[model samples]
Target chain A: MKKENISDAVIRRLPRYYRHLNELCSRGVVRISSHSLGQEMSITASQIRQDFSCFGEFGQQGYGYNVEELKAEIGHILGVDNDHHLIMIGVGNLGHALLQNFPFSQCGFTVDAAFDVSPAVIGTAVNGVPICSMSELDTFIQSHSVDVVVLTIPQTVAQDTADHLISLGVKGFWNFTNIELSSQVPDVQFENIHFADSLLTLSYRIANR
Target chain B: MKKENISDAVIRRLPRYYRHLNELCSRGVVRISSHSLGQEMSITASQIRQDFSCFGEFGQQGYGYNVEELKAEIGHILGVDNDHHLIMIGVGNLGHALLQNFPFSQCGFTVDAAFDVSPAVIGTAVNGVPICSMSELDTFIQSHSVDVVVLTIPQTVAQDTADHLISLGVKGFWNFTNIELSSQVPDVQFENIHFADSLLTLSYRIANR
Candidate 1:
């Protein structure tokens, strides 16, 4: 499928498909049909086919898709085929854990440095990624050419940190702050994962369901 | 508008609107039009109007919505106006920090208890919420009647944890694990936040844009 044709929703589901395929591959499953894949993903078979067809044909009439090849395709599409540099902001509890248990490296993105406002956390290393002061953000971004920033700062400071990163030419942000920053930066692609908002929405669904 | 008429996408965006309005209300902004709200959210004005219309008609012909009233209405729609009990599974770094920071109570969700397998973390309080053993999950959940669960377990254990929670009658899940479990539980609402996938998609968009 052409990258330009892929929707944001489809792109988000690619990693999901990749992770499931990895599990199936580990279990010695060689191939999977769109129907079964859809069943596993709780989506319709035709939806799976349509999503996959956006890039290129990968399924045969009866043979379905080769697990390993599909996995590789998704990995490449996600840019995990090439290692990307990551810099994390806010070495607080969540940030510290993220740095320690960094998952991107396994999927081809590595955290080279971390930044924080806490003096106690500075000069420390979580999973060998050294924590630096927030004052060094511009220098670090310039030196490392950090492509992605993992934001775990407080809600009040999220916008400022985002502005700083964007000023440094950072391409994308994984924002974990509860604050909504849709108006702060228009050019940068931001993925806001508000934990409280998610829980509240879920609660509402469960109560109303 | 009737709650049944609200789409999932619209429901998801309600929180974003709520956050934005809350910020505006705090800043003493009394009124906002659909155009201005859409501008702030990076969405179209008509789309914002449609979403709000699903809840109720709050805007006038020329005038928009009252900032404070809109914020409260959105909060009510999201079920964040009243306090709801919440439980956290996998009290690791992310969990601990989330407990410490993030005003869940202010948002009408409270982290009453946290569960983990580690004995060291058990019986301890991370930001006033008591850390409990995984063995106590059923008891705590049942007694507290927690409607929502915040999952931060490893991908390997996410499915099992979800299954266990579902079996206990938990209806809502905010899953942070990269692993997708859409097929594992069909009835309950599942919101998956894959940080890597978000970052990758954002990077791709930034690179292509």
Candidate 2:
């Protein structure tokens, strides 16, 4: 779809829009005006209209938007409708918790395998996803088509692990190592999740308030 | 500290700067120029200078910024030096993992307690933090000076739970409930963590690339 001039900010908002639409769909809401949707999401109606215009028109002048239709469109833009094979590195407390709790399938990601350096968790399984040893990672990636690698590994090894994964043809990364991972490879994409950053932001707000 | 007119974007970047400066301090790098810092962070040197100027004069014309001083100043701005007593709600897998793994004390947040509705985990503890029954939440908050509440609860009850906690005078929230928790209370601040958004962003880049 027309993604040429779309900003990263707009791309990030697509998921939020998709999520709201999913909620509306579940509630059996068929349609919504930009004004009402914007009010609920704390966004401006004009901004909402402008963001949607980057992809394509989903609403008429007075008819508003079809909830399911808008949701499907945004989901399509987010590539959430595509089947993605994902693997997790570092089956630590955080990794194990994610494997057990996160609804990865809802966003079209399936955790086919999880790799860990620990012998204790290597043969174990969390929610049917097998936890394999680090030694088998190369062979598994060679045999399986892994589209995304979840890096819950330590900060020291996160970059090296990501580089190795990139060499193995993995292009997407969901990194939780707190260190920002940047690759020299052009096609490699990383989304770093820093819990400390979020907490510090909250603390800043509280302190400033 | 001159906090007025500081934009949210600038506020968000404070933690990142704090983290980088922290690494520099640990590595015995006493000083750094904004150009070098900006290059490493992928931010413009002018933007870095502008963001730091919002707090105060951090670096001299040619002397550059003292690593320890900048880190401490940013930490103070982010309230990392304050002793914040944080209590976590919902001692599920995610909560358990966070309690076990997250270095909250580094950011001046201590997980004094965790609450769970489930009787199975009510009396247990994760990483020395006691898991209390949800029934005791009110009493616990009444007695303890809790500055922040970590919501790891289900989406269905997230808003209601936040409202209840707001009524109890808690103002800061680190929410992992997937749902956006908004409060009518003027002082309450929420930091929502959406793993799906990050994952979807990664997926979108992968698909679009």
* Model 2 chain B worst lDDT window (10 residues): B2-11
Instruction: Please list, in the order the candidates appear, how each scores on TM-score for chain B only.
Output: 0.91, 0.96
| Model 2: per-residue Cα lDDT over B74-127, one tens digit each | 999899988899999988778877887789999989889999989898888889
Q: What TM-scores do the predictions have?
A: 0.83, 0.89
DockQ of every candidate structure:
0.48, 0.68
**Candidate 1 has what TM-score?**
0.83
Write one digit per residue (lDDT tens) for candidate 1, span A1-209.
34565666777677678778888899899999988988876778998888888778788898999999998887776667667777888888888777766576766777888888889989988888899998888877787767778888877888877776777788678888866665455667777766666666675676567
The reply for model 2, stretches above 4 Å from the true place, is: A117-120, B62-64, B117-124
List the candidate 1 regions with Cα displacement exceeding 4 Å: A1-7, A17-29, A33-35, A44-64, A117-119, A133-138, A181-187, B1-6, B117-119, B133-139, B154-168, B181-187
Task: For residue A133, give model 2's deviation from the true position in Å.
Answer: 3.2
User: In terms of DockQ, which candidate is strongest?
Assistant: 2
